[model samples]
Target: MQTIVYDETNKINEQAVQWMEDLLNFAADKLNVAEHAEVSVSFVDNAKIKEINREYRDKDAVTDVISFAIEDDEEDLFKEFEGSGITIPRDLGDIFISYDKAVEQAEEYGHDINREIGFLLVHGFLHLNGYDHMTVEEEKIMFSLQEEILRDYGLKR
Candidate 1:
């Protein structure tokens, strides 16, 4: 059971939400996950996200999206998850998306807002799933997965 909660109304990003569901299911299939998971996504303004970033990460900037992974601290949460190949989860976490930034980026990139939202949702989901761009190779894999999942959901270019 995956739950998506918004901090505010997201009446505009319906396509992105649908694509996110597709991406989540694709990832679960690829990872062989079969259990309940909850993820919250917040549509916040730039100021709110900037405050969150500064308070949590000490970064005084408004980012596009942010994800908080609580599983990293739960030792027993995945006692045999990797070995037994089982998906056991209750609440995955939350994904905070800045709509202001998203709109700006969409226009700057000359792409549909839906595509930009899809990209952001995928990026945030990757982070929650333990994907990071700390290195070039890691970045390639994460980004590749992002594009692949989006393409799979018919979110072209």
Candidate 2:
């Protein structure tokens, strides 16, 4: 799978972007996404992320990461990736990350900004792959898989 990193704001550093790319590539490899599968990661400011969160999720808050899936219908989402008459490379989804939030959270959590960004990217990718943490059970599964992917990628806090 290919991950394209875009900096909507000039806040993110090159190292962070490169790390994001590596983390996403690692995630895609572990999750078994198509080699041609495309996921876009945009680094934005808190204002942009808050706007997106309000517009898409109906929550007027600034989140560290937000995902926009291609297919809201769970059943049809993976079908597009199966190459069932689909000609183009699958556009998995878009992941928006707030650089400001990443920095803040990293400092708050006592971890490096790289690890926070990696976590957000992996979390957003999982959401794109039909993972959610709304409930207790879902949280357990999603977080466990996330931690596993991060550990396997050698990105630990």
Candidate 3:
């Protein structure tokens, strides 16, 4: 699993970026992602994320994270290429996280910044993998899985 991280805000340090990489690797292992899978994670400020949210979701409010899953649209197309001796890397998707919201949530939730960021990363990763919390049942399942993954990753609240 290759996780390309872009710190658009330039506020995240090297250590935080490295930790995110390690966390994504661990998540991929736990989720059984393909070895050739690739995902991009971008950290941006509130203004940028709010713009993205408004453009993509039509909501003017700032969101903590947003995921764009490639498989959601091109799953069948990729399946056709399977077993044809083509080694196409599974480009899962991109995840954009709001750095400002992360800091605020960390303080609000009474946890470290790493924990909040890790939670957001895992949440976005799950969304890329087809997890949704649109309904009550779905919320229970998705939230439980997220908590389990976070706990196992040692990012407990």
Candidate 4:
């Protein structure tokens, strides 16, 4: 499947790695992504995420995650790489999360860091797999999927 590759320049603990992998697997299973599919995620601070949100989305604030799907000729989420049996790396795009925000929200929500990271990972992965909360119905589906994934990962607190 399209695995979630983390950009670790921002510093990630072991739990962050585990949660990232788990959430990617969760999304792959639920989305029925093929073997060797690919996805990527980046952990950023509030300042970096705010810059991304503003530059790409024209929003002037730090947000949870943003998804940019790499479209193919057939408009499939993931593209097939050259001649390899593997499906095209989903290029599933990158997710930018503010560690500051995650930690802050975790404190506010009264949950462990692991659980909070798990939730954020699931939320970001869902966005990569074509999930969004831009509308009421979209939110229901996206959140339900996120909750289910997190529950499966034993992240609920």
Estimate every model's Cα lDDT from 0 to 1. 0.78, 0.87, 0.93, 0.72
Give me the runs in candidate 2 sitting further than 4 Å from their true place. 13-15, 73-87
Residue 142 in candidate 1, Cα distance off native in Å: 0.7
Q: Where does the lowest 10-residue lDDT sum fall in candidate 4?
A: 71-80
Tens digits of per-residue lDDT, candidate 2, 1-157, equal 6778889888777776677778888888888888878999999999999999999889999999999888577566555447566656678899999999999999999998888988998999999988999999999999999999999998898
- The runs of at least 3 residues in candidate 4 whose Cα sits more than 4 Å from the true structure, single-residue gaps closed, are 2-10, 72-87
User: What is the lDDT ranking, best to worst?
Assistant: 3, 2, 1, 4
Q: Which ranges in model 3 have alpha carbons more than 4 Å from their true place?
A: 73-75
Name the Cα RMSD for model 2: 2.7
Best by lDDT: 3
lDDT of candidate 1 over 10-115, digit per residue (tens): 4546665665666666765564554577677788999999999999999999999999976776565766567876666656678888988988999999998778
TM-score, prediction 4: 0.82
- What is the lDDT for 10 in model 1? 49
lDDT of 4 by residue, 1-157 (tens): 5455555445686766775776777667877865666677777778888898999889999786666666424354333554666543445666667777888889999998677767877787777667789999999999998888788767787
Better of 1 and 2 by TM-score: 2
RMSD of each: 3.8, 2.7, 1.4, 3.0
How many residue pairs clash in all the candidates, one count each?
0, 0, 0, 6
Cα TM-score per model: 0.82, 0.88, 0.94, 0.82
| List of clashing residue pairs for candidate 1 | none
Report the poorest 10 consecutive residues by lDDT, candidate 2.
74-83
